[model samples]
Target: MYSEKLKYYEFFAGVGMARAGLGGDWQCLFANDSDQLKRQSYSDNWAGEAFDSRDVAEVETTDLDGVADLAWASFPCQDLSQAGSKAGIGEADGTSVTRSGAVWPFLRIIRGLAEEGRHPALLALENVVGLLSANSGNDFRSLCGALNEIGYRFGAIVADASHFVPQSRPRVFIVAIRREVSIPAALRTELPQSPWHPQTLLRAHAGLSVEDMAAWVWWSPGAPPPQKDFELEDIVDLSDDADWNSEEATQRLIGMMSELQLNRLAAAKAEARLMIGSLYLRMRPNGDDRNVQRAEIAFGATLGCLRTPKGGASRPRIIVVEGERVRTRLLTVAEAARLMGLEEDFVLPETYHECFRLIGDGVVPAVVRFLADRLLEPLAKHAKEGVFTTINGRKLA
Candidate 1:
């Protein structure tokens, strides 16, 4: 019965990155997002099949297609983001506010489907790592409680995009399974795993209610294969026409750097090869205790994380240092797409705001593929075949 291609639903689907990550092997039965521009981008790329453009809050059980094996939701992170309001997810009674509140509707949909006996076998919710300690850990507990009320057992793993791409985006993925489903012991851990389950997550688990703690799972997706031997130069274009800031502007930016940052830039200049780095504007207290906007330079094996470009501070700047030369420019749309591990031919939104935000707010398809190929698919197969027992680490047929 599980021989057919496993199917999924993409909730909070931004530009269908989840669909892309799931690839052609897994069938995407439906995709939903409230943002119209994101939907337009998805439509252009996906031919507008099985998509709901309305807010998830407005979506009901009847709006979805038939039951799916998995449901993926990369809900908005504004409220839960450490960089944002830090408002948390609010009370779990469905009175969610701001974008972070989107999770409420997402959970509501799952409950709605469950009421009709159409809930997915697995639920994967992706959010910023801040969700681990939001509201002194109460938010995380509430989130799990909501899932428990809907008849699911949940665990989480924190995965960073830098493992697969030239960008540093650490996100938390909470995977919930219907209680009746039997998880393959090989795919779970008796305790939190290193790197995937950090101290904050451990603390959050410690805070769960007795019943919820009993229902908690410790997922073991396993380590992904070694990353590609790629660098910033591979994803970024530095040609003359690629919007490099003028020499004067570049010098002004350099001047804004503190002594420590300039020292870092000088160290980069000493390198033999042309190196690319990211620069951002931050407000720091000047000598007189007044806040002054300063340009901070960051360089490493990967670029900094991508964020929605709502203002100058939110938009990232690329810094190129080849010997004595220093140039800076806003990150390009194509570059942002590449950072998110999108295909070269992927159709991006017409405007930068829509295109950049979609990528920033979306999941890395490569990371999704890693999770699906490693744990999700195998878990689904085991559950469907009714392989409820494992003897000496082998499945019983």
Candidate 2:
């Protein structure tokens, strides 16, 4: 049966997180990405592989030889990310395009596939939250419009890694299925505005009203039960040989903190037992035209979003508040992997920086699994049965 064994193609396939999440039932027919380091990591973790290390813009549809049931794209978030320039999809010199503008090439490939009669049954896109507001929502609108043009109906939701792990990584996922497949009317109705159905998404695109979205589902499989017992300590590696920052370096980091941050640190220090805190250095406005580094600290059971440490300011620091003393260290690559729902058996590069970057840029496997279980698996089952189905009681067929 077509749906019994779903085959998928992955674009921007970083470290195979989406593949991991889809689990064993789904087969990845083809995977493509431009980054060699990431491809190396992908090859290391999943042996007996042939990854297409080509730029998405240059990859032709013919290169994808087989028919796939699903297509997953975790495209680069550099342009749409809040941490980077808000350069929404900028136009480049007549022909070539910028990095963020790579989404167009992705669409082009989809169109090419459709033209060749090889379009996938379902499509999934993953990216940062900033895409919703990029260019005051025009970018997202264009994206949805393109999918609509290509004979697919899509639903979007913002899933946070904290629901399944200890990190606070929140990302937006867009799931699209071919229009021919009948989706019941109940699943397409408007839902109450919440995390998954944020007001921003509803208000971002013009003509995207609740009533008009007969195909747009507010995909929520119910939130994971409150993890009151979970804590950051649960994921921390306490090996004796774990790398800890030197005393001098730790003092320097503390000294760089502003008075407000210092006060927060002092409060954590006052605790009787050791407390765990996460630190990030942000670029804040200093005066009129310049920006200054400000050390921000959060004392909570969960860590802040794990970001790629490209620069000194982007790296996240881990702080251990023990009574009156504080120890500081860079978050280990192993810890970052754990936060992203990667098992310990997952392979890593010898260089610490590369491992951290790969994890930071990749998706959380647990969140992907949640999406697959709730959205993809059910859709596959319905397709296999060749039945018109409604997610809710509302019927369309």
Candidate 3:
């Protein structure tokens, strides 16, 4: 359900996953990425026109055709991911390491778009939940400032795929629209509130609250409510597409564990667990929004935020649910994709590791689609309508 009138340009276009999620109607005027293999994957899935394949940092604005009606950027989160080595803007070994803090370059892209008046009507950004807390929240502030400078208003929500599916993957989605849009007045009337009302994080690290860890904030007063709740079931595939050496890895992990730690893991059916979660989920601050309902804790029903390691074969304990029992295993790439609303049919690379890593590193297709339908389409409509009001002051007719 795309708005045919709008045009799109997918940046950091990983395997054309976003393009696929957004569907066929919206014209893909341009797509950019640095990986040749990923470009091939994209070419296989999308073949009408030849897209530009180059580093986003190198591509000039003049190289692209128009300003585009929408721009999708799930920029590399290596520097901003909690699951990554805590390099904190310092150079590290792995690509996922080294906090490049590249939000500034992306901001330049937006500014370029805005300059030509061909900038997208909506900008959709997705990243690990850690982005909100990394660097004492300075990274987030800079991003907000950049958007404000570009004359766009935005709202961010930290959601998990579990709400839409059954998987416990959570991520933060930021949606921005050009302030010139008029339809938000009507859209604002329909926005929904966060389920876990701005409760502070009980635990504090680098001086941040639980609420600071994950909370949806709206810069635009009239922004629409969140509609991107996904669950594991929505994106879970029934087929096995991974070659998991769980036995060896588990044995090695068990060999490395202390006697007591070994006993705890050995008692469980699954051997490997995500070690990063412990680092990420610490205790909340004292006497903050300390209201824990008798039911939420008992049922483990809180909407767990999405982690950057959702696709890692080696990290984060993977648990499988059966009739009554839950078992643990390494989550498959397909399952990870499904959790993000990216189906196997989307044509990822053949290498299991590459595909899994890439999908895990990418954004949820379903959520992206939801943004396209609910936010992007409406923004475009508002632009086309050319009227603004805090409330429904003008009729489409």
Candidate 4:
């Protein structure tokens, strides 16, 4: 079965979350990331595995052990995200020259593999949903065009982490198959589907050249496997041993909230059982349109998407209410890991910041597994049978 249960290369492989999601069955031939803390955590959890800690720019073709059945890359999204600088990976003509430009190196490695006739049968890219509109949609076109130039047909699915976890993170997965690999028509839809193909995605596709559109497939991976509701309260660490904030600190947090936020907290406090809430301090406009810091809390159901602590407010604080008492604390590394769909046994970074950043930068494993079960497995099955589809584009370079 596709070289005995599929093999993959994990690029920009932040802490091997993709590998964790893919699980033990899929052999990981190579993995690379530049972060020291992430490298340490990844090595700890995935010992005896080939883990390359070099920056993507420093990665050479020889570092790759062999041709993989798939390559999953979760490249940097800071430049493309609103939480960071929205500078983006530049335009179609050139990409970001900074570290955020890691996607280009990722593409280079894939292209290099193709040149050596060792290209993987499939490639999956995960990044912030902002990729769809980054640089006014040109970046999306460039990515699609690059795959086309390398002789692959591709599509995108906007998978939200909340579907599989209690975190409200929506990421875009650009799943591509080499032109020669046979994908059944069942995976394609004549019309764009909702949720996966949002209006922004449709607009991005319409802006593409006709040639790229022809190479495009509106991937229909079917509804995600029915997952029971994963609520904010379900994954939280509510025991007293948790690093709950002190009485003074909790009161200070409450003091910073606006009227609306206080009302939400009051509503949550009125609930029949203990309440779990997540808080994020953000810059919002006052009556005069002047920016002011405000505390915002999501009372139930789901927490806002986790973000690395680029700023103090970027990290979320958790609040708990039981009877007449309330407590608050920074999101613990353990809770952060669970929010990312990591099991309790998974080794995390040593410090809170490191672990939080690792989890924040990671993709949800359960979501990945869901996609693997429905989309990737079928493609591999078709590949093993020598099911063939012809390429309509000429290979470049």
Please report the candidate that would top TM-score against the real structure. 1
- Give the Å error, residue 163, model 1: 1.3
lDDT of each: 0.84, 0.77, 0.54, 0.80
Per-residue lDDT value at 66 in model 1: 74
For residue 8, give model 1's deviation from the true position in Å.
Answer: 1.8
Each model's total of backbone clashes: 0, 0, 33, 0
Among all windows of 10 consecutive residues in model 3, the one with the lowest summed lDDT is: 292-301
How well is each residue in 1-397 modelled by candidate 2, as lDDT tens digits? Answer: 4435678898999899888998898888899889999999899988997799988878998888777768899888777787776677654231535467877888888988877666776789898888888887877877787788787888788878887888888898888887767664434445643667676666654445443365565665565546544567777755447688888988878877888899998889777676887887788887889988877889886888887664233787788887887777778777787777788899888687888778777899888998887777777556545653333322322
If scored against the real structure, what TM-score would every candidate get? 0.92, 0.89, 0.68, 0.91
- Candidate 2, residue 352: Cα displacement in angstroms equals 1.7
**RMSD to native for every prediction?**
4.1, 4.4, 9.4, 3.3
List residue ranges in candidate 4 displaced over 4 A: 1-3, 91-95, 231-234, 287-289, 311-313, 322-324, 387-397
Best by lDDT: 1
| Model 4 Cα lDDT, one tens digit per residue, 58-170 | 88778888667789999888887777777767643343474456788788878887787777788999988888898888889989999999889999989888877778889
Q: After superposition, how far is residue 163 of candidate 3 from its true place, in Å?
A: 2.1
Select the stronger candidate by lDDT from 1 and 4: 1
Residue 323 of model 3: what lDDT? 34
